[model samples]
Target: MKEICIVEFTSNLGLKEPQTGKEPGVNRLPDWLWKHNLHKSINPKNIIRVDPPKYSNIKDPETNILNADSLVTYSREQAYLINNLLSANKFPFVLGGDCSILLGVAMALKQKGNYGLFYLDGHTDFMDISLSETGGVGGMAASIVTGNGHEKLTNILNLSPYIKEENLWCIGNREYDDEYENEIRKSSATYISLQELRKQGIANCTKKFLSEIQNKNLDGFWLHIDVDVLNDEIMPCVDSRTPDGLTYDEFNELTSYLFQSQKLSGLEITILDPDLDKTGEYTKDFVNNLTSTFNKHFNN
Candidate 1:
């Protein structure tokens, strides 16, 4: 039986376009999820929440990344917390403030040894600071995790290139800026775009991805899901949105396959903006789908 630990990351400091004036409700996800009976479905006793981190408005002049200093500090702290949970043999369900939290998660996993990454998002997130218009760490998460971004953020915990390029597999990516697309083409990471995902079928494509990971003989792998990957009609509460993403059924199917693989060590859900979910419909749907799917696969 897998022991699950719910870790809430409430820092949006890495976002280039800071949510000012109004409430940045992404940080309140843990509360919203809990209020919506997420704990009841996933076992309330198993849930554990990490204290929210502080955010800063300062941006690094050289790197153009927002809150670079604070980001590094909080990332290490988040990593420490995650590492402790891993040591206790707990499967972490990290609810994120943004994709930048993947940096901290990667840092935690790197301490144990080489691990693969299953990046499931709408955007590739491989943009470097130079090309990134917002300078949000979230945009450069994949690049930072692979040791291809600014030195300070990429070298967190001295684990430069936290995860190897060859070990990373990106799926469900549909939004690719020109520079990001070029970078993806040059990257060693395995990428299966949403278009191709439809062509080959999610199951067959995932099977192939898992085979490659197994061939690499990795210790374990992390799953990163950015909510923007879901269809705009179904999930429209993210910081950024694009048309024609995966349907709820398709996403559920894909996550089910991943959880059943037994190689998944940790998971993070990012980019859901509660401020945009005024009717609470999106949040409710997300909680329902995620909790039901997670319970079906990991419930002991």
Candidate 2:
């Protein structure tokens, strides 16, 4: 039995206020994600909070630890905490301050040994410091895991490469810079688009993805889902929501199958911008989907 551990990281990362636009009074926004609400929504009463360490602000965007500190320490703490929890037969399900928090989950899981990574997001998040149009560290987590970004992050777990390129599969990515596109081609990673997902069907695509890994005798698989992959009409609480993304049922079905795969080692859910959520519709959907998936596959 895999014990589910939730890490609440409701950080006001970098002190950046929520962006303008978005309906008011929606619980989808970040302001209302209290532990109590999480308890009511997700099963398993044993949840932990991983608060980020304070960091100093710097003028240079790249040098700004205030925002980047969370990204670096996220995996460090996650790795330490989850290793112990997993030893006790628990599976860590990390909730986010942003997608950057995945760096920690990756680090934590790396301790179990090399495994495949299934990244579902709107953007590739493989941009390096030079390629990143936005200096947000969340956009660079993929690059970091692939050993392209900050040495601080890649060096985690003391492994030269935190994540092997062959073990990575990117899904639902629609936007990318020319450099990012080029990197994807050169790298050993595989990917399918949101349009491709809709055309081929999420289950078919996921099955295909699973086929590639089935031969590897994977120790486990990590699932990193960025809410931005959903169309803003349904999940408008993200900083970068796509126009043609998956529907709630579509996402739910996908997660249900994924959990049922029994290969899933851990999960990390990120980039839910509660600031933009209008009527808590996003929260309701998120809670329901999370609840349904756990009950169907993990409640035994």
TM-score of candidate 2 on Cα atoms, chains taken together = 0.86
lDDT of 1 by residue, 1-300 (tens): 667888888867767544454434677767777777777777733665555456555578977887888788888988898888888778888888888888888998898788999999998888767787777888789888999977899998789888898888878888755656778778898877899899989999888877877887887789999999999999998877899999999999999888877778889988888778877888888889988887887643
RMSD of 1: 1.7
TM-score of model number 1: 0.94
TM-score of each: 0.94, 0.86
lDDT of 2: 0.68
**How do the residues 229-273 of candidate 2 rate in per-residue lDDT, one tens digit apiece?**
877787777766557777877888777777776678778777776
Off by over 4 Å in 2: 11-38, 55-66, 176-179
Enumerate residue pairs that collide in model 2. 26-278, 26-279, 27-280, 28-274, 29-274, 29-275, 30-274, 75-104
Worst ten in a row by lDDT for model 1: 16-25
Q: What's model 1's overall lDDT? A: 0.82
